[model samples]
Target: MTSQNSRQTLIIPALGGLYARLNDGVETLLRVIAGGFLAVHGSGKIVDPFGASEMVEGLGFYPGAFWSPLLAATEFFGGILIALGLLTRPAAFAGMIVLLVTVWFHWVTMGQGFSGAEKSLLWAAALAFFVVRGGNRHSIDARLGKAF
Candidate 1:
């Protein structure tokens, strides 16, 4: 049987060692970027939390007033939590749900299909990763020695 070291070397002999050393940092970077972009994307909604009421209602979310603000908070505050790696799993799960809704909205509601829902699809996948992995050693969860 091929040892782990040999398998890694066989894949990329030259950069394998570098990749191993930077794997955690790279994971941290992915988390930060994903969370940061999510926060930025929701920043506008946060300012006018109720502005999406009509949109939410259109998606069959009743009482646009409540759902709109909830969506805003889930995107804005949840993104912050994910970025900080605090409550990472819950935050990511929330974000994933939001992204999935967008996917449906674009793909089925708007009839844009794959071309329109592509970004939401990718974002959902990324959040799914965090939902499963939580934060890494560089995260606040790690520093606090506790994670949820």
Candidate 2:
């Protein structure tokens, strides 16, 4: 090819346009899936006293075992925010932290594999995307004049 033709091809918009679309599709799916998973996990804590208390003790997140309600609330509300694509950057950051911790837990019990640790890795990647992208378009933040 000529130099000019090669330059045009290099800058062609179609050069992997399909792949970019696929990535967007995957991102949308992850937004839904991660949001739903977080909602359920938070709801579980609310419904199960034992589970909540056990989490407080097991995780030792609080200085003096101040109950798991704080974490539960973060999960539930953060999930909702992410689902609506409102305040997505902060929500995704928090969700990424949770996923990373989950990965550590799975690594201990489930060992290294696609069935366990890899799930957390993927969750981290998805959440990180939202954190960096801030929910692109068609999000609550965008519709409400607050997408950032």
Candidate 3:
């Protein structure tokens, strides 16, 4: 066999063994972190609608009041999805949009880049991973599939 075929022969099994453990470890960690971040941020907005309104206005999203509710729900509800690993891709995409708006509010309008996109970036990447992986191996999607 050629080198490509030989490489695949050796690689497939090794990848199978290694990827599960690796994905499980990373996904669990990311899910927890993403959930926590959303919960905290959403709670803040829910608790302080006025402050959130000001933020929405600053971001120029129109109807600042409406922005508050949408943002709060996105973070809070999306966080729950992230926690459950259900609809994680959409949730992550929503979350990414939220963060981009926030970043734009702070970085573009306010002229700063200090909020640290690291966690948001990480969460977005992890969510994208799940989107591609389809919550494979250990997820509600998989469980439901097996159950049905």
Candidate 4:
């Protein structure tokens, strides 16, 4: 092969490999940021688990006394699990459900329109991505040889 062709062949493969690593790194970063934010945001709910009883009941979840702690645990602990890429898909799936509910609550219940529901919509999309993609090579799921 000519010098230029040889260089092209080498460079192309090198770039492909770099791109794969970069994609994995970006995925890991997204997981960490999303999960960490959920954990921190849920911290207040954990402290006063029953404080949301009225709001949750207003959302028609019913018996907020029962679901309050469950919501708190799902966000806080599930966020930790997702951040670690341990049972990531399940955690993300659960988070997605919570976010969807928030979307409905903000848009329909509060009549806040797209602007109010936008954050929950974005979070739901992120969680949905994780639900589909699971954890990448840099994740604990990958290390454990688990698909989900």
In the order shown, the candidates' Cα RMSDs to the true structure are 2.5, 5.5, 5.1, 5.9
Q: How many clashes show up per model? A: 0, 0, 0, 0
Top candidate by lDDT: 1
In model 1, the runs with Cα more than 4 Å from the true position are: 1-9
Please tell me which model should have the higher lDDT, number 2 or number 4.
4
Prediction 3 TM-score vs. true:
0.71
Query: Which lDDT tens digits does candidate 3 get at residues 110-147?
Result: 66665655455555566556556544445565666631
lDDT of 2 by residue, 18-132 (tens): 6556765666667867777877777876565345656556655553234566567667777888877888889988888878877876776447555778877987888888899
Task: For residues 48-124, write the lDDT of model 1, one tens digit per residue.
Answer: 99999999999999999999999999999988888889889999999999999999999999999999999999999
Over the full model, what C-alpha lDDT does candidate 3 score relative to the true structure?
0.67
Candidate order (TM-score): 1, 4, 3, 2
lDDT of 4 by residue, 29-79 (tens): 999888889888788888988888888899998899988887898898888
| Candidate of highest TM-score | 1
**Model 1, CA-based lDDT:** 0.92
lDDT of 4 at 48: 89
Report how far off residue 4 is in candidate 1 (Å). 7.7
Tell me the spans in candidate 2 whose CA falls farther than 4 Å from its real position: 1-26, 48-50, 63-67, 108-115
